[model samples]
Target: MNAKIIIVLVSVVAAAGAIATFYSQAHAPLERVTEGFETGYGGWAPDADVPIDPNTGQPVDWYVARSTDVSFSGTHSLKFFIDGRQDDGTIWIERKVLLREGARRVNITFDLYSGEESFNTIAVVCAYAGFKDPEHEGELTVLGPANEVAGWKRYSLAVDIDTGNAQEAWVAAGISVRWETHMTYYLDDIIIEVT
Candidate 1:
């Protein structure tokens, strides 16, 4: 009777340990982005410091039309939408980090509501290392004009940034919606995962 009780107790303890380990691994926090980078918006001012892009007319900073608002601070990010495709004046904070030469997998994940495939915007993920100085250069990436992308899609961008003096990383990631763009669209829970 004594032996049986000891064995049962040992088994229970072992199982609990295994479960705790797995849970921690699954929910571990991602590495934080490097310091000082920021998400910019112009708030719909033709006289704002950052002007709209001539080619796209999308505001370079947080500048939104009537009834639209966007802001991101720290890990908490929010972009309120009033159109099908995400418009200008919406952004998440940015940071600069380092990616050594090797196989780097960047998982860019964001959530969208269930709806039609009407997102007519170009999403770019431009990362620059040595951004503090910029002369040390790193990597610049332009992700997509993905058409069939609708109803909550996630993107995993895998790139091999060669080893060099490029010891920094800055991301200019955003959605560029053009003129006359309309449709109620929303974006939230933006995460940059590195593996």
Candidate 2:
């Protein structure tokens, strides 16, 4: 009887240990990255799409650079300017992020600053996260209108991708022109998480 009881106790302890190990592995902590654009662009690069000038056949004016005029957290933020006179254009900043080998999900959050709040939709906030870099406006997903708040507003987007064999993902945020007019906006405090 003593031998049988000892064997049963040993088996139960071993099973408990195995369960704990499995639980820990399945509930591993997520990896996070953040960029406030305080010091610099932090690997993020700007891209844009605009209509061509009929006279020159060249794209219209668009600009992206670091500015100190407005920011969400730091003294500096990324500024985007575009001539939406044609009622069409999109501008965004994108970066490639290294991910764990088996990472399956990505979450992105950021803040956008607009000059004033209005019901009129001049531009729409947009974001992207995928294996390939976004090359056109259609590749981006519109999060919401940028003029929702007068100062700064937060936006978030998440994507579930098959990263089993992938090592990196491209993430981006920006705005799309809605009304025919020139527009400028600032972006800052970007956070990304992979799990």
Candidate 3:
């Protein structure tokens, strides 16, 4: 009887340990990456889509580069420029992140610095996270207005994807032109987490 009780207690303890391990593994993040643009683009690259210029028959002017004009945290930030004369265009910086082989969710958070706030929306903030890289503006999800605040503002996006056997996922954030005019914006302090 004593031996049987001891074996039962051992089994219960082992089960409890296994349960704890599973809980922690399920709740913990699989991967995380943060970028401030202090050193460089941090594996991020810029992409854009704009209307073709009538004369050049090519996409209108759009630019993205590291700059010191304004930053949310560090001394540098990513600058995005777009010609909104036609009132249509999208600009964003994108990067790939590693993911565990399974169904997982990605959470992205970042800061945007606007020169000023206005009721008239010049552009809207957008983000994307999925199994494939976003090739067109339509693939991005609009989060909110970019000009909501005069200075730095925080934005977040979460996406659940079936990674399956894939080991990489793409994440991006930027702005979509709204009003007809030229516009500039800054992005900084980006954080990506996979769970």
Candidate 4:
């Protein structure tokens, strides 16, 4: 191609790149956020169907609890739970900020706490389409273990959604905690970021 033609092509490519970057950033900027949850309650207690912390006003960091009335009473902080082997209970917290469509990628992270003496690995599970998908079938997921000495530890998962080359794509995202039925768990400061 001629010099003039090459220059035009380069300019077009640069402009296109800038637009794409801006679009992506606009959608999924980075930060820690509660995203969504019910406000009013104040705190979380064990075996409470209303698993999320009312004080924090953040949804339970796990499956939607069986009932909203179910409430947590102690532990002095946020908590998450699961039905034992029978496995039932969820806390369906609606979404606040949808992951930006152009999200370059995301890291879902949270600090989990356990009041038990020794516990199984608690999952800071991320569900692409959390409540909408039952059994988490057809959902992309990232889980962190919380079996360690339970206090507060930063756990995170980095993900890139494979939209199969579709024009519009995103990984549906939400967090969940699973454990032997009747287990107690806690969560705080979950976040998603585009870096």
Q: Which candidate is the best by lDDT?
A: 3
Predicted structure with the largest TM-score when compared to the true one: 3
Q: List TM-scores for all candidates, in order.
A: 0.40, 0.84, 0.86, 0.46
Q: What does candidate 4's lDDT look like per residue over 1-195, in tens digits?
A: 799999999999999999999998666554334422245322212222324445466533343232232223222324444533333233322232344334455556555555543555544444342223233322545454455564555566665653333333232333344553456555554454543
What lDDT would each prediction earn against the true structure? 0.39, 0.90, 0.93, 0.44
Give candidate 4's TM-score: 0.46
| Cα lDDT of model 1 by residue, 1-195, tens digit | 699999999999999999999998655533333221124331111111123556677644342222223222233223323232333322322445455444244444444322355454433222222234222112233344423454544433443344346555444333333433343333434455543
Give the Å shift of residue 139 in candidate 1. 9.3
The superposed Cα distance between candidate 1 and the true structure at residue 117, in angstroms, equals: 2.9
Ranking by lDDT: 3, 2, 4, 1
Q: Model 2 lDDT vs. the true structure?
A: 0.90
Give, for candidate 1, the lowest lDDT window spanning 10 residues. 41-50
lDDT value, candidate 3, whole model = 0.93
**Candidate 1 TM-score, true structure as reference:** 0.40
Q: Per model, how many backbone clashes are there?
A: 16, 0, 0, 26
In terms of lDDT, the poorest run of 10 residues in model 3 is 49-58
> Model 4, which residues run further than 4 Å from truth?
1-78, 87-96, 99-102, 117-142, 162-181
Q: 70-152 in candidate 3: lDDT tens per residue?
A: 88886999999998888899999999999886647999999998899999999999999987889899999999999999999
